[model samples]
Target: MKLFQKLTPKALIFWTIGDQAGKVYLGILGNLILIFAIFEPAKINYARVLINS
Candidate 1:
C-alpha cells in the first residue's frame, strides 16, 4: 500500500505494535473499569486503575 511504502521496516513494526496495542487496551481497560465499578469498596473514594509496576 502507498501509506505502508512510506514507513521503513522497523518503523512499520513499531507502528503495527502501537496500532494493535491501542485497540486492545481499550477493551481490557473497559472491562477493568466495569469490574472496579461493580466490586470496588464503598469506603475508598479514589481511582481504581490497576497499575502493574
Candidate 2:
C-alpha cells in the first residue's frame, strides 16, 4: 500500500542510522513496541476505511 511504501524508506533510514549509532537493540525494541501499539490499530482502521470506500 501507499502508506507502507512511504514508510519503508523512512524506516530503512532510521534503522541504518540506529545501527551505525550502536543503538540497534534499543531501536528494534522501540520499533516493535511502536508497531504493536500504534501501527496495528492504524492498519486496522486503514483496512476498514478501504473496505468501506
lDDT of 1 by residue, 1-53 (tens): 88878999999999999999998999899999998897777424334333322
lDDT of 1: 0.81
lDDT of 2 by residue, 1-53 (tens): 77666777779798778777777677888999988998899999999999999
Question: Each model's C-alpha lDDT?
Answer: 0.81, 0.85
Question: What is the number of backbone collisions in each predicted candidate, taken in the order shown?
Answer: 0, 0
Q: In candidate 2, which residue ranges exceed 4 Å CA deviation? A: 1-30
Error of 1 at 45 (Å): 14
**Candidate 2 local lDDT, residue 7:** 72
Q: Tell me each candidate's TM-score.
A: 0.51, 0.38
Query: 53 in model 2: Cα distance from truth in Å?
Result: 1.3
